[model samples]
Target: MSIKGQTEQQQAEAQLAVGYYTELFKPPLEPKKLPPPAKLPPVPQPVLAQRVPGAKEESVSGAWQIVADKLKEQILLRHYSPQTLKSYSIWMWKLSRFLENKSPETVTTSDVQRFLADLAVRQQVSASAQNQAFHALLFLFRYVFKRDLGDLRDTPRARFQLASFPFRD
Candidate 1:
Protein backbone atom coordinates (compact mmCIF):
# COMPACT_ATOMS: atom_id res chain seq x y z
CA MET A 1 0.00 0.00 0.00
CA SER A 2 0.96 3.65 -0.48
CA ILE A 3 2.52 5.62 2.44
CA LYS A 4 -0.67 7.81 2.67
CA GLY A 5 -3.01 4.78 2.84
CA GLN A 6 -0.67 2.98 5.36
CA THR A 7 -0.63 6.08 7.60
CA GLU A 8 -4.47 6.30 7.57
CA GLN A 9 -4.79 2.58 8.41
CA GLN A 10 -2.20 2.94 11.25
CA GLN A 11 -4.17 5.90 12.75
CA ALA A 12 -7.45 3.87 12.69
CA GLU A 13 -5.77 0.90 14.43
CA ALA A 14 -4.28 3.21 17.10
CA GLN A 15 -7.73 4.67 17.84
CA LEU A 16 -9.26 1.15 18.19
CA ALA A 17 -6.43 0.03 20.55
CA VAL A 18 -6.88 3.13 22.72
CA GLY A 19 -10.69 2.54 22.86
CA TYR A 20 -10.16 -1.11 23.88
CA TYR A 21 -7.71 -0.22 26.64
CA THR A 22 -10.04 2.56 27.97
CA GLU A 23 -12.96 0.06 28.21
CA LEU A 24 -10.74 -2.51 29.96
CA PHE A 25 -9.43 -0.01 32.56
CA LYS A 26 -12.83 1.68 33.29
CA PRO A 27 -14.17 1.48 36.97
CA PRO A 28 -16.92 -1.18 37.52
CA LEU A 29 -19.70 0.86 39.23
CA GLU A 30 -20.55 3.64 41.68
CA PRO A 31 -19.24 3.06 45.28
CA LYS A 32 -21.66 2.71 48.23
CA LYS A 33 -22.38 6.01 50.06
CA LEU A 34 -20.76 6.48 53.51
CA PRO A 35 -22.98 6.45 56.60
CA PRO A 36 -23.51 9.74 58.47
CA PRO A 37 -21.34 10.36 61.57
CA ALA A 38 -22.98 9.44 64.89
CA LYS A 39 -23.72 12.26 67.29
CA LEU A 40 -22.03 12.00 70.76
CA PRO A 41 -23.51 13.14 74.08
CA PRO A 42 -22.27 16.47 75.39
CA VAL A 43 -19.67 16.32 78.21
CA PRO A 44 -20.19 18.23 81.45
CA GLN A 45 -17.64 20.89 82.33
CA PRO A 46 -15.75 20.75 85.64
CA VAL A 47 -15.99 23.63 88.12
CA LEU A 48 -12.46 25.04 88.12
CA ALA A 49 -12.60 26.80 91.52
CA GLN A 50 -14.18 23.85 93.33
CA ARG A 51 -11.67 21.45 91.79
CA VAL A 52 -8.87 22.89 93.95
CA PRO A 53 -8.49 21.24 97.39
CA GLY A 54 -8.37 24.64 99.15
CA ALA A 55 -11.64 25.80 97.60
CA LYS A 56 -13.37 22.59 98.64
CA GLU A 57 -12.50 23.32 102.28
CA GLU A 58 -14.87 26.30 102.36
CA SER A 59 -17.56 24.37 104.25
CA VAL A 60 -15.03 22.98 106.78
CA SER A 61 -14.87 25.17 109.91
CA GLY A 62 -12.23 23.38 112.00
CA ALA A 63 -8.63 24.62 112.08
CA TRP A 64 -7.24 21.17 111.28
CA GLN A 65 -9.63 20.77 108.37
CA ILE A 66 -8.37 23.99 106.81
CA VAL A 67 -4.78 22.96 107.52
CA ALA A 68 -5.33 19.53 106.06
CA ASP A 69 -6.83 21.01 102.92
CA LYS A 70 -3.78 23.25 102.62
CA LEU A 71 -1.50 20.23 103.07
CA LYS A 72 -3.32 18.37 100.31
CA GLU A 73 -3.01 21.38 98.03
CA GLN A 74 0.73 21.60 98.68
CA ILE A 75 1.27 17.86 98.13
CA LEU A 76 -0.70 17.93 94.88
CA LEU A 77 0.93 21.16 93.66
CA ARG A 78 4.37 19.61 94.16
CA HIS A 79 3.26 16.47 92.25
CA TYR A 80 4.13 14.21 95.20
CA SER A 81 3.13 10.57 95.04
CA PRO A 82 -0.38 9.55 96.12
CA GLN A 83 1.21 7.42 98.87
CA THR A 84 2.76 10.57 100.33
CA LEU A 85 -0.65 12.26 100.44
CA LYS A 86 -2.24 9.25 102.11
CA SER A 87 0.54 8.94 104.73
CA TYR A 88 0.54 12.64 105.52
CA SER A 89 -3.24 12.77 105.85
CA ILE A 90 -3.14 9.77 108.19
CA TRP A 91 -0.48 11.39 110.42
CA MET A 92 -2.42 14.66 110.48
CA TRP A 93 -5.53 12.82 111.66
CA LYS A 94 -3.49 11.08 114.36
CA LEU A 95 -2.03 14.37 115.51
CA SER A 96 -5.46 15.99 115.69
CA ARG A 97 -6.74 13.08 117.74
CA PHE A 98 -3.71 13.25 120.05
CA LEU A 99 -4.30 16.95 120.71
CA GLU A 100 -7.99 16.36 121.53
CA ASN A 101 -8.79 18.17 118.28
CA LYS A 102 -6.93 21.29 119.30
CA SER A 103 -6.50 24.10 116.77
CA PRO A 104 -3.53 23.49 114.47
CA GLU A 105 -2.40 27.07 115.02
CA THR A 106 -2.00 26.39 118.76
CA VAL A 107 0.05 23.19 118.30
CA THR A 108 3.70 23.76 119.18
CA THR A 109 6.95 21.81 119.06
CA SER A 110 6.14 20.43 122.53
CA ASP A 111 2.85 19.08 121.23
CA VAL A 112 4.69 17.33 118.42
CA GLN A 113 7.27 16.01 120.90
CA ARG A 114 4.55 14.55 123.09
CA PHE A 115 2.88 12.92 120.10
CA LEU A 116 6.17 11.38 118.94
CA ALA A 117 7.00 10.29 122.48
CA ASP A 118 3.61 8.66 122.82
CA LEU A 119 4.20 6.72 119.57
CA ALA A 120 7.59 5.50 120.85
CA VAL A 121 6.90 5.00 124.56
CA ARG A 122 3.23 4.09 124.61
CA GLN A 123 2.20 2.77 121.18
CA GLN A 124 5.56 0.98 120.70
CA VAL A 125 5.50 1.52 116.92
CA SER A 126 8.49 0.37 114.89
CA ALA A 127 11.37 2.83 114.22
CA SER A 128 10.44 3.04 110.54
CA ALA A 129 6.81 3.77 111.41
CA GLN A 130 7.89 6.44 113.87
CA ASN A 131 10.21 7.97 111.25
CA GLN A 132 7.41 7.95 108.71
CA ALA A 133 5.16 9.80 111.12
CA PHE A 134 7.95 12.27 111.85
CA HIS A 135 8.42 13.06 108.16
CA ALA A 136 4.68 13.51 107.69
CA LEU A 137 4.60 15.97 110.58
CA LEU A 138 7.70 17.71 109.22
CA PHE A 139 6.00 18.26 105.85
CA LEU A 140 2.86 19.44 107.65
CA PHE A 141 4.70 21.96 109.84
CA ARG A 142 7.26 23.27 107.35
CA TYR A 143 5.13 23.27 104.21
CA VAL A 144 1.46 23.22 105.18
CA PHE A 145 1.26 25.13 108.44
CA LYS A 146 4.39 27.18 107.66
CA ARG A 147 5.73 26.73 111.20
CA ASP A 148 9.10 25.69 112.57
CA LEU A 149 9.22 22.10 113.96
CA GLY A 150 12.22 23.13 116.13
CA ASP A 151 14.78 20.57 117.31
CA LEU A 152 13.17 17.15 117.66
CA ARG A 153 15.86 16.07 120.14
CA ASP A 154 13.31 15.52 122.91
CA THR A 155 11.30 13.08 120.79
CA PRO A 156 11.75 9.53 122.09
CA ARG A 157 13.21 6.99 119.69
CA ALA A 158 11.50 3.64 119.16
CA ARG A 159 13.86 0.86 120.12
CA PHE A 160 14.39 -2.10 117.80
CA GLN A 161 15.06 -5.71 118.88
CA LEU A 162 16.57 -7.80 116.08
CA ALA A 163 15.42 -11.43 115.73
CA SER A 164 17.74 -13.90 114.02
CA PHE A 165 16.24 -16.11 111.31
CA PRO A 166 17.71 -19.56 110.41
CA PHE A 167 18.46 -20.06 106.69
CA ARG A 168 19.79 -23.00 104.69
CA ASP A 169 21.48 -22.80 101.25
Candidate 2:
Protein backbone atom coordinates (compact mmCIF):
# COMPACT_ATOMS: atom_id res chain seq x y z
CA MET A 1 0.00 0.00 0.00
CA SER A 2 1.07 3.61 -0.45
CA ILE A 3 2.17 5.55 2.73
CA LYS A 4 -1.21 7.46 2.94
CA GLY A 5 -3.18 4.21 2.38
CA GLN A 6 -1.06 2.36 4.94
CA THR A 7 -1.64 5.19 7.50
CA GLU A 8 -5.42 5.06 6.85
CA GLN A 9 -5.41 1.25 7.23
CA GLN A 10 -3.42 1.55 10.50
CA GLN A 11 -5.94 4.12 11.83
CA ALA A 12 -8.86 1.80 10.94
CA GLU A 13 -7.13 -1.13 12.76
CA ALA A 14 -6.51 1.11 15.80
CA GLN A 15 -10.21 2.09 15.86
CA LEU A 16 -11.19 -1.60 15.79
CA ALA A 17 -8.82 -2.36 18.66
CA VAL A 18 -10.29 0.56 20.68
CA GLY A 19 -13.84 -0.64 19.95
CA TYR A 20 -12.98 -4.17 21.14
CA TYR A 21 -11.39 -2.84 24.32
CA THR A 22 -14.46 -0.63 25.04
CA GLU A 23 -16.78 -3.67 24.66
CA LEU A 24 -15.03 -5.30 27.64
CA PHE A 25 -16.36 -2.42 29.85
CA LYS A 26 -19.98 -2.70 28.50
CA PRO A 27 -22.55 -4.62 30.59
CA PRO A 28 -23.41 -8.12 29.36
CA LEU A 29 -26.80 -8.65 27.64
CA GLU A 30 -27.62 -11.55 30.00
CA PRO A 31 -27.33 -11.33 33.81
CA LYS A 32 -24.74 -13.68 35.32
CA LYS A 33 -25.41 -15.46 38.64
CA LEU A 34 -22.95 -14.67 41.45
CA PRO A 35 -22.43 -17.00 44.41
CA PRO A 36 -23.70 -15.57 47.72
CA PRO A 37 -21.08 -14.34 50.15
CA ALA A 38 -19.81 -16.98 52.55
CA LYS A 39 -21.34 -16.74 55.99
CA LEU A 40 -18.86 -16.09 58.83
CA PRO A 41 -19.00 -17.73 62.24
CA PRO A 42 -19.81 -15.36 65.09
CA VAL A 43 -16.77 -14.19 67.06
CA PRO A 44 -16.61 -15.21 70.70
CA GLN A 45 -16.29 -12.34 73.18
CA PRO A 46 -13.49 -12.31 75.74
CA VAL A 47 -14.38 -13.21 79.34
CA LEU A 48 -13.15 -10.47 81.66
CA ALA A 49 -12.55 -12.81 84.60
CA GLN A 50 -10.80 -15.52 82.64
CA ARG A 51 -8.72 -17.85 84.84
CA VAL A 52 -5.02 -17.13 85.37
CA PRO A 53 -2.58 -19.87 84.40
CA GLY A 54 -1.68 -22.29 87.24
CA ALA A 55 -4.34 -20.73 89.47
CA LYS A 56 -7.49 -22.26 90.92
CA GLU A 57 -10.61 -21.60 88.86
CA GLU A 58 -12.48 -20.56 92.00
CA SER A 59 -10.11 -17.63 92.47
CA VAL A 60 -11.80 -15.64 89.65
CA SER A 61 -15.33 -16.95 90.03
CA GLY A 62 -18.28 -16.07 92.30
CA ALA A 63 -19.27 -12.48 93.27
CA TRP A 64 -15.76 -11.30 92.45
CA GLN A 65 -16.26 -12.18 88.82
CA ILE A 66 -19.25 -9.89 88.55
CA VAL A 67 -17.27 -7.00 90.06
CA ALA A 68 -14.27 -7.73 87.85
CA ASP A 69 -16.38 -7.75 84.70
CA LYS A 70 -18.08 -4.48 85.59
CA LEU A 71 -14.80 -2.85 86.51
CA LYS A 72 -13.32 -3.79 83.14
CA GLU A 73 -16.34 -2.39 81.31
CA GLN A 74 -16.15 0.92 83.21
CA ILE A 75 -12.39 1.25 82.64
CA LEU A 76 -12.68 0.58 78.93
CA LEU A 77 -15.68 2.86 78.52
CA ARG A 78 -13.78 5.80 80.03
CA HIS A 79 -10.80 5.16 77.66
CA TYR A 80 -8.36 4.78 80.57
CA SER A 81 -4.81 3.60 80.02
CA PRO A 82 -4.07 -0.15 80.14
CA GLN A 83 -1.83 0.40 83.18
CA THR A 84 -4.79 1.95 84.99
CA LEU A 85 -6.88 -1.10 84.11
CA LYS A 86 -4.13 -3.47 85.29
CA SER A 87 -3.59 -1.57 88.55
CA TYR A 88 -7.33 -1.44 89.23
CA SER A 89 -7.72 -5.15 88.48
CA ILE A 90 -4.98 -6.07 90.95
CA TRP A 91 -6.51 -3.85 93.65
CA MET A 92 -9.96 -5.26 93.02
CA TRP A 93 -8.58 -8.78 93.32
CA LYS A 94 -6.86 -7.87 96.56
CA LEU A 95 -10.04 -6.29 97.87
CA SER A 96 -11.99 -9.41 96.93
CA ARG A 97 -9.53 -11.58 98.79
CA PHE A 98 -9.57 -9.25 101.80
CA LEU A 99 -13.35 -9.26 101.92
CA GLU A 100 -13.35 -13.07 101.67
CA ASN A 101 -15.53 -12.88 98.55
CA LYS A 102 -18.09 -10.70 100.34
CA SER A 103 -20.61 -9.23 97.95
CA PRO A 104 -19.70 -5.73 96.71
CA GLU A 105 -23.04 -4.45 97.99
CA THR A 106 -21.99 -5.35 101.52
CA VAL A 107 -18.66 -3.50 101.35
CA THR A 108 -18.51 -0.43 103.64
CA THR A 109 -16.18 2.48 104.26
CA SER A 110 -14.93 0.78 107.42
CA ASP A 111 -13.95 -2.27 105.41
CA VAL A 112 -11.95 -0.02 103.09
CA GLN A 113 -10.32 1.68 106.08
CA ARG A 114 -9.18 -1.61 107.52
CA PHE A 115 -7.82 -2.75 104.20
CA LEU A 116 -5.79 0.46 103.82
CA ALA A 117 -4.49 0.11 107.36
CA ASP A 118 -3.50 -3.48 106.69
CA LEU A 119 -1.54 -2.37 103.62
CA ALA A 120 0.26 0.37 105.55
CA VAL A 121 0.91 -1.33 108.94
CA ARG A 122 1.45 -4.93 107.92
CA GLN A 123 2.29 -5.03 104.25
CA GLN A 124 4.55 -1.96 104.73
CA VAL A 125 3.83 -0.87 101.17
CA SER A 126 5.32 2.50 100.18
CA ALA A 127 3.18 5.65 100.31
CA SER A 128 2.78 5.75 96.56
CA ALA A 129 1.73 2.09 96.50
CA GLN A 130 -0.88 2.71 99.19
CA ASN A 131 -2.10 5.83 97.38
CA GLN A 132 -2.44 3.88 94.16
CA ALA A 133 -4.39 1.19 96.02
CA PHE A 134 -6.59 3.86 97.56
CA HIS A 135 -7.33 5.46 94.19
CA ALA A 136 -8.02 2.05 92.66
CA LEU A 137 -10.46 1.17 95.44
CA LEU A 138 -12.04 4.60 95.24
CA PHE A 139 -12.63 4.10 91.50
CA LEU A 140 -14.09 0.66 92.25
CA PHE A 141 -16.51 1.98 94.82
CA ARG A 142 -17.56 5.02 92.83
CA TYR A 143 -17.86 3.50 89.36
CA VAL A 144 -18.12 -0.29 89.65
CA PHE A 145 -20.23 -0.39 92.82
CA LYS A 146 -21.97 2.90 91.97
CA ARG A 147 -21.52 4.26 95.50
CA ASP A 148 -19.50 6.92 97.20
CA LEU A 149 -16.57 5.70 99.36
CA GLY A 150 -17.62 8.21 102.07
CA ASP A 151 -15.30 9.58 104.72
CA LEU A 152 -11.92 7.87 105.04
CA ARG A 153 -10.28 10.41 107.36
CA ASP A 154 -9.45 7.70 109.93
CA THR A 155 -7.66 5.45 107.43
CA PRO A 156 -4.06 4.86 108.49
CA ARG A 157 -1.75 6.85 106.25
CA ALA A 158 1.27 5.15 104.67
CA ARG A 159 4.34 7.14 105.70
CA PHE A 160 7.12 7.99 103.22
CA GLN A 161 10.52 7.11 104.70
CA LEU A 162 13.44 9.32 103.74
CA ALA A 163 16.89 7.81 103.25
CA SER A 164 19.22 8.63 106.14
CA PHE A 165 22.84 9.53 105.33
CA PRO A 166 25.74 9.01 107.79
CA PHE A 167 27.22 12.39 108.92
CA ARG A 168 30.93 12.79 108.09
CA ASP A 169 33.14 15.53 109.65
Candidate 3:
Protein backbone atom coordinates (compact mmCIF):
# COMPACT_ATOMS: atom_id res chain seq x y z
CA MET A 1 0.00 0.00 0.00
CA SER A 2 1.12 3.61 -0.66
CA ILE A 3 2.23 5.96 2.23
CA LYS A 4 -0.91 8.14 1.94
CA GLY A 5 -3.17 5.05 1.99
CA GLN A 6 -1.33 3.58 5.04
CA THR A 7 -1.55 6.96 6.90
CA GLU A 8 -5.30 7.18 6.16
CA GLN A 9 -5.88 3.64 7.48
CA GLN A 10 -4.00 4.44 10.72
CA GLN A 11 -6.02 7.66 11.12
CA ALA A 12 -9.28 5.71 10.63
CA GLU A 13 -8.22 3.07 13.21
CA ALA A 14 -7.34 5.82 15.76
CA GLN A 15 -10.73 7.46 15.20
CA LEU A 16 -12.49 4.09 15.65
CA ALA A 17 -10.64 3.47 18.93
CA VAL A 18 -11.58 6.92 20.24
CA GLY A 19 -15.21 6.40 19.20
CA TYR A 20 -15.35 3.01 20.94
CA TYR A 21 -13.90 4.49 24.15
CA THR A 22 -16.34 7.39 24.04
CA GLU A 23 -19.32 5.03 23.59
CA LEU A 24 -18.13 2.77 26.44
CA PHE A 25 -17.74 5.58 29.00
CA LYS A 26 -20.72 7.68 27.90
CA PRO A 27 -22.73 9.22 30.77
CA PRO A 28 -26.34 8.20 31.30
CA LEU A 29 -28.81 10.43 29.49
CA GLU A 30 -30.71 12.89 31.69
CA PRO A 31 -34.32 11.82 32.18
CA LYS A 32 -36.80 13.81 30.11
CA LYS A 33 -38.65 16.38 32.24
CA LEU A 34 -41.60 16.32 29.85
CA PRO A 35 -44.87 18.12 30.62
CA PRO A 36 -48.30 16.84 31.66
CA PRO A 37 -49.37 13.23 30.85
CA ALA A 38 -45.67 12.35 31.18
CA LYS A 39 -43.66 11.20 34.18
CA LEU A 40 -40.92 13.45 35.58
CA PRO A 41 -38.74 10.37 36.18
CA PRO A 42 -37.63 9.08 39.57
CA VAL A 43 -35.36 11.22 41.80
CA PRO A 44 -32.54 8.70 41.23
CA GLN A 45 -31.12 8.77 44.76
CA PRO A 46 -32.86 7.49 47.88
CA VAL A 47 -34.55 10.61 49.21
CA LEU A 48 -35.20 10.98 52.98
CA ALA A 49 -38.84 9.91 53.05
CA GLN A 50 -37.97 9.23 56.72
CA ARG A 51 -35.18 9.09 59.25
CA VAL A 52 -33.50 5.90 58.05
CA PRO A 53 -30.34 4.54 59.60
CA GLY A 54 -27.14 6.01 58.17
CA ALA A 55 -29.21 7.94 55.62
CA LYS A 56 -29.70 11.70 55.34
CA GLU A 57 -33.19 13.13 55.73
CA GLU A 58 -34.57 14.25 52.38
CA SER A 59 -38.15 14.75 51.29
CA VAL A 60 -39.74 11.62 49.83
CA SER A 61 -43.31 10.50 49.20
CA GLY A 62 -45.08 7.24 50.19
CA ALA A 63 -45.51 5.37 53.48
CA TRP A 64 -42.55 3.06 52.86
CA GLN A 65 -40.22 4.97 55.19
CA ILE A 66 -42.54 4.57 58.17
CA VAL A 67 -43.18 0.95 57.29
CA ALA A 68 -39.46 0.38 56.84
CA ASP A 69 -38.79 1.99 60.22
CA LYS A 70 -41.29 -0.40 61.79
CA LEU A 71 -39.81 -3.31 59.86
CA LYS A 72 -36.47 -2.89 61.59
CA GLU A 73 -38.19 -2.99 64.96
CA GLN A 74 -40.16 -6.09 64.02
CA ILE A 75 -36.99 -7.80 62.95
CA LEU A 76 -35.18 -6.80 66.12
CA LEU A 77 -38.07 -7.52 68.48
CA ARG A 78 -39.81 -10.49 66.83
CA HIS A 79 -36.84 -11.78 64.85
CA TYR A 80 -38.66 -12.11 61.55
CA SER A 81 -36.87 -14.09 58.85
CA PRO A 82 -35.47 -12.35 55.77
CA GLN A 83 -38.18 -13.92 53.61
CA THR A 84 -40.84 -12.69 56.03
CA LEU A 85 -39.30 -9.22 55.96
CA LYS A 86 -39.48 -9.09 52.18
CA SER A 87 -43.02 -10.49 52.11
CA TYR A 88 -44.18 -8.09 54.79
CA SER A 89 -42.51 -5.20 53.02
CA ILE A 90 -44.32 -6.14 49.82
CA TRP A 91 -47.64 -6.20 51.66
CA MET A 92 -46.96 -2.79 53.14
CA TRP A 93 -45.99 -1.48 49.73
CA LYS A 94 -49.25 -2.69 48.22
CA LEU A 95 -51.25 -1.26 51.09
CA SER A 96 -49.51 2.10 50.81
CA ARG A 97 -50.15 2.24 47.10
CA PHE A 98 -53.74 1.12 47.62
CA LEU A 99 -54.36 3.84 50.15
CA GLU A 100 -52.55 6.26 47.88
CA ASN A 101 -50.13 7.12 50.72
CA LYS A 102 -52.85 7.70 53.26
CA SER A 103 -51.65 7.69 56.84
CA PRO A 104 -51.68 4.19 58.36
CA GLU A 105 -54.11 5.35 61.03
CA THR A 106 -56.59 6.10 58.25
CA VAL A 107 -56.49 2.58 56.76
CA THR A 108 -59.78 0.93 57.60
CA THR A 109 -60.66 -2.75 57.85
CA SER A 110 -62.74 -2.35 54.73
CA ASP A 111 -59.67 -1.16 52.88
CA VAL A 112 -57.71 -4.20 53.99
CA GLN A 113 -60.59 -6.55 53.23
CA ARG A 114 -60.97 -5.08 49.78
CA PHE A 115 -57.25 -5.38 49.21
CA LEU A 116 -57.26 -9.08 50.13
CA ALA A 117 -60.31 -9.67 47.98
CA ASP A 118 -58.66 -7.96 45.09
CA LEU A 119 -55.57 -10.12 45.64
CA ALA A 120 -57.61 -13.31 45.49
CA VAL A 121 -59.82 -12.34 42.55
CA ARG A 122 -57.55 -10.18 40.44
CA GLN A 123 -54.15 -11.69 41.22
CA GLN A 124 -55.50 -15.25 41.73
CA VAL A 125 -52.71 -16.07 44.16
CA SER A 126 -52.49 -19.44 45.93
CA ALA A 127 -54.00 -20.10 49.36
CA SER A 128 -50.69 -20.14 51.22
CA ALA A 129 -49.56 -16.97 49.51
CA GLN A 130 -52.86 -15.25 50.21
CA ASN A 131 -52.80 -16.34 53.80
CA GLN A 132 -49.20 -15.21 54.24
CA ALA A 133 -49.92 -11.87 52.67
CA PHE A 134 -52.98 -11.49 54.87
CA HIS A 135 -50.94 -12.21 57.97
CA ALA A 136 -48.26 -9.75 56.93
CA LEU A 137 -50.80 -7.05 56.22
CA LEU A 138 -52.62 -7.88 59.41
CA PHE A 139 -49.42 -7.51 61.35
CA LEU A 140 -48.94 -4.08 59.88
CA PHE A 141 -52.52 -3.12 60.65
CA ARG A 142 -52.53 -4.31 64.22
CA TYR A 143 -48.99 -3.51 65.35
CA VAL A 144 -47.89 -0.73 63.05
CA PHE A 145 -51.18 1.02 62.49
CA LYS A 146 -52.48 0.22 65.99
CA ARG A 147 -55.80 -0.63 64.37
CA ASP A 148 -58.15 -3.61 64.49
CA LEU A 149 -59.59 -5.65 61.60
CA GLY A 150 -62.01 -7.77 63.71
CA ASP A 151 -62.59 -11.30 62.31
CA LEU A 152 -61.60 -10.56 58.75
CA ARG A 153 -60.17 -14.02 58.11
CA ASP A 154 -59.29 -14.84 54.56
CA THR A 155 -61.79 -17.13 52.82
CA PRO A 156 -60.20 -20.57 53.09
CA ARG A 157 -59.22 -22.23 49.84
CA ALA A 158 -61.81 -24.98 49.34
CA ARG A 159 -60.30 -28.46 49.45
CA PHE A 160 -61.60 -31.85 50.55
CA GLN A 161 -59.93 -33.09 53.73
CA LEU A 162 -59.98 -36.86 53.17
CA ALA A 163 -59.17 -38.66 56.44
CA SER A 164 -57.92 -41.85 54.80
CA PHE A 165 -57.64 -43.66 51.48
CA PRO A 166 -57.81 -47.44 50.74
CA PHE A 167 -54.53 -49.16 49.93
CA ARG A 168 -54.03 -50.40 46.33
CA ASP A 169 -54.22 -54.18 45.81
Best by lDDT: 2
Per-residue lDDT, model 1, residue 89, is 83
Candidate 1 lDDT tens digits, 93-157: 78877766666777899999999999999999988899999999999999988888999996789
Instruction: Give the higher-TM-score candidate: 2 or 3.
Output: 2
* Candidate 2 structure quality by residue, lDDT tens digits, 61-140: 45576787788888878988777878888888787677665666789999999999999999989999999999999999
What TM-score quantifies how close candidate 1 is to the native fold?
0.61
lDDT of each: 0.77, 0.79, 0.64
How many residue pairs clash in model 2?
0
* Candidate 2: Cα lDDT at 16: 97
Each candidate: RMSD: 14.9, 11.0, 14.9
Model 2 Cα RMSD, 1 decimal: 11.0
Mind sharing the TM-score for model 2?
0.62
lDDT of 3 at 162: 47
Q: Which stretches of candidate 3 lie over 4 Å from their true place?
A: 1-62, 153-169
lDDT of 3 by residue, 49-78 (tens): 444442222222334676667764665478
- Cα lDDT for residue 41, model 3? 26
Clashes of each: 0, 0, 1
Q: Which pairs, if any, clash in model 1?
A: none
RMSD of 3: 14.9
